[model samples]
Target: MTRLPVLRTPRLTLRGWTFADTAAALDVYGHAEVARWLSPEMTRVPTPSAMRLLITRWIAECVGLPPPAGRWAIERDEDKRVVGGAVLLRLPPGHEDLEIGWQLHPDVWGNGYASEATYALAGWAFSHDVDEIFAVVRPDNARAAATVRRNGMLWVGETRKYFDLDLEIYRLRSADLKLGAQTSQRPPGHGNDD
Candidate 1:
């Protein structure tokens, strides 16, 4: 498991999570609007301390050698604060397909941050030799589906492959990516000089 590199887009930065980000993590996860899309059990983590534990574990697993595929914080470039989170993790159990997902602060819902972060994630995965990256969304989550579409993913209908919940899967290949994806995701230790 290679570590995630710090990625830059025109408007946001994608980077590793740390304990210092716990407050923003809690606020994003605890919000009813954000948690509604996640699983029922996830909604129960509404406290900062609980978010701290999750962040601590995530850092341990993902910031080390053989890091498990995991989420990275979506930071606002102008403010240097985490306004959301994005993932490039493998699907549970089988770990066959890499899944891409994101949750943004409700205040930033209509912005294109999700799409930007996802594009960077897809590019980074492809650069690392991953063949297919997926985005699984509840059929009703039009916004997420739209973000996948913007990143040039094709709808694969439905499946209960991940989380044991029926979901609409969107897939993208390295070749399917629009221009600039390959160059956008700089390698680990490679600064986002682009």
Candidate 2:
């Protein structure tokens, strides 16, 4: 496993989560708007201390993560606040099942941050040797679906295949990286939150 490097887009900085980011992480992760679509592991951090502990664990865990598979703190470099977070990880314990996801504070929703953060993460992941990246969105999560779509991921429709829940699956081949709506100033329906 190689250390994941910081990734940046025109407006966002996808960097490793720091211990000092606890309060920001707590503020974003604790909000119902941000937590609603995230996994239980993210929404269930009971306290700031718990959040810090978990972030510490994740940072430690990154050491063993294969290339292009690590979590990032999504920062709007202009404001330097933690607007949300992004993830690029190998799903189900295999290197082939790479996934990309993003979460943004509702207050910052509709500003294209989710799409930007997600696209940046996906681009970085594609730079590695993997052939493709997948995004598993709950069937009902329209916002997330839009985010993936805007990033040029092709929908493979719904299935219970990956996370055990019925999810809408999407994929982007490495050859297609940065070739579509991902580099646009504002993708269609860009105001939606994830």
Top candidate on TM-score is 2
TM-score on alpha carbons, each prediction:
0.85, 0.89
- After best superposition, candidate 2 residue 38: deviation in angstroms? 1.5
**Model 2 CA deviation exceeding 4 Å by range:** 40-42, 93-95, 187-194
Error of 2 at 75 (Å): 1.0
lDDT of 1 by residue, 1-194 (tens): 46667888888998899889999988888888788897433664678889999888777768653432567898999988899888777677697888877888888776667767777787778777778888888888777776577667888889886778888988898776774354434442233211
TM-score of model 1 (CA atoms): 0.85
lDDT of 2 at 99: 81
Q: After superposing candidate 1, which stretches have Cα over 4 Å from the reference? A: 39-41, 64-68, 179-194
lDDT per residue (tens digit) for residues 1-194 in model 2: 55768888888888988999999888888787667777634554568998899789889988888777888999888889998878887766344688888778777877777777766777676667777888888878887787677667889888766656778889888655566453545542455443
* Model 1: colliding residue pairs: none
Q: List the lowest-lDDT window of 10 residues for candidate 1.
A: 185-194
